[model samples]
Target: MPNSLRPSSRAAASSARSASLADVAALAGVSTGTVSRAMSKPEMISEATRVRVMEAADRLGYVVNGAARALAMRRTKTIGAVVPRFGSSSFPAMIQALEATLAEQGYTLLLSAPEGRREKEPDILRAMLERGVDAVALLGTDQPPAVLSMLAAHRTPYVQMWAPPGSGSDAVGFDEHAAGAQVVAHLAALGHKRIGFVGGRSKDSERARHRFEGLALALARHDMALDERAIIETEYGFAEGFTAMQEILGRRTPVTAMVFGTDYLAAGALAALDQGGIAVPQALSVASFNDNDFAAYLHPPLTTVRLPIREIGEAAGRLLLARLGGEHFEPPPMHVELIVRRSTGPA
Candidate 1:
């Protein structure tokens, strides 16, 4: 056969080539042993040499075969994370706190933001398990059955954040239902009998469902009912809140107050009320959940329920680490506070 008809050795090699420690070592002018040390025991190597090896690996798009390494060493030194989305300030800060805590013990965070795609969690967790992540950290308590099944099948240790009942023993979070009820109680105390709610659709977020249920229960206790037509469930976005507010107003229920599921949603509702020439507290009292970073800085500081998010993140990390280390850890109860700010007042 002619050279063109047969397999070309050069092209075949080019197509089959994948960067390995030997390749990285060659490019960085270091031994393969030194490259291995830089990757697995960077603390034992000089910082300058480690940086050189890392740069070379990056240039060659090299990823250590974590599965193979884990089988040999029995640990990946990684924690896999799954969350709804990182759009708001909360998820990033929460994850950052967890990362900081894990880093102390030489663990790295591998994250997946299913963002509007919560259904992908099972697949993400499966991939992480296959890659040999040592543990997993989940955002909400109400994980899907498939996700729970995959974890159980692999016997992968995991912990839940934003804790409530139904998350099993490894839950670490505050009272989401209590926070929602507290918002309503604050408004009810202010003599607002009629109220509307704007938040993420419950189908998309387990927390959203808990919050609404708590608010509804509180409303019933106060001799007030959540009007089906007045409830506006939308995306957890500013623009979504704006549109939701418009829809609620169009219902003509004439609710005296409005409760939002998140501070971002509350901020958007405030803008819509302003554009419509309605003054907060005087015309419509506004309050929300998650006293997130911007809650206290809104045009009229928002009244919201405060969640100890950083503490939650840190505790979840510590809890996971303890379990991984074969140490006992009991999660302390976290409380939520209702903050009364300028955005809300009397009916």
Candidate 2:
């Protein structure tokens, strides 16, 4: 009889009924040592023998203990993702795709949110490291010096997303600046000579800054400029958009059109304009970035720039995985385009 068949073995087997090396060996008519080798270093076993052992293990409800596997391999097949937030449709959809793709390679995705608050980044990274993440994904190109130092100290692979053009950072996203410029160019082509831009406050967002720079470049190209008084920078929110538009309306500049930093902002602008008795595209043209799903259903619809938001997230996942596996990667530059709609007309 096999060693596992001894009287003493009966209790041990019962205690670990979920399955054990001995159980697999017995079921496959092999030695316990052979089963151990098959579980730990499968390549050493013959293909026929390995398949039999694996099938027996499956029948016996055997699962490779990841903790023990990690200890032996010195690798944790988990990636960390740290983003500003994850409330929008784009983030969720991309994350779903990324998770599914990673699952194919037996990897797991660990997500963390700092809400664009720099103060929380270090703590969040520490937590991720504690969980033994193999790599990390960051948002935007302008990573803070402290975060960069943390990643370097651990020698962990990191990636940035939703970056600007010419960022000089390892990233995977479209040029936000160009997206903004497209909005400006569209407004200009619609015969709107005077344009007011509703922008997100740039204190914590390098992406927002790039978007504004692109709009400025577009204005300069048309021999026009944003009225300094009409430019309203507020938090990235609908209320902020509403208030920004109201402030622009308060200005003496005859605002023929208003470009917003995001679709959410545009929606708020629409509400404000409605309440103020100002007609859209007639009294004032409204445009925004990130052709969000909500943009299509707005009262007059939004003419905006379409962001490849889901693709950006999926790319971020692949980039992190490649780096974790010691694969060489040259992160691809992504591009965004303008989606023309009925939000603007001849001014």
Model 2 alpha-carbon drift over 4 Å, by segment? 1-64, 88-90, 251-253
Best by TM-score: 2
The CA lDDT at 266 in model 2 is 90
TM-score of each: 0.80, 0.80
What is the alpha-carbon RMSD of candidate 1 to the true structure? Answer: 7.7
Considering only N, C-alpha and C atoms within 3 Å, which residue pairs clash in candidate 1?
163-173
Q: Which stretches of candidate 1 lie over 4 Å from their true place?
A: 1-72
Compose the digit string of candidate 1's lDDT tens values, residues 1-347: 11112223332343358777777776777788988999889999988888888887776778889778877989989999987767853778889999999998889999988766867888888899887898999988778899989888888889998867556678988777788778878887889888888877888787788888888888888888666777888878788788888888777787888888888888888888888888987888899988888888887899998888888889989999998999989877788898899999888
Compared with the true structure, model 2 gives a TM-score of 0.80
Number of the predicted model whose lDDT against the real structure is largest: 1
- Clash-forming residue pairs, model 2: none
TM-score between candidate 1 and the true structure = 0.80
lDDT of 2 by residue, 141-230 (tens): 767687888889999887777765555545777776678778877887888787788776677777678788888888898877687777
What are the per-model C-alpha RMSD values against the true structure?
A: 7.7, 5.0
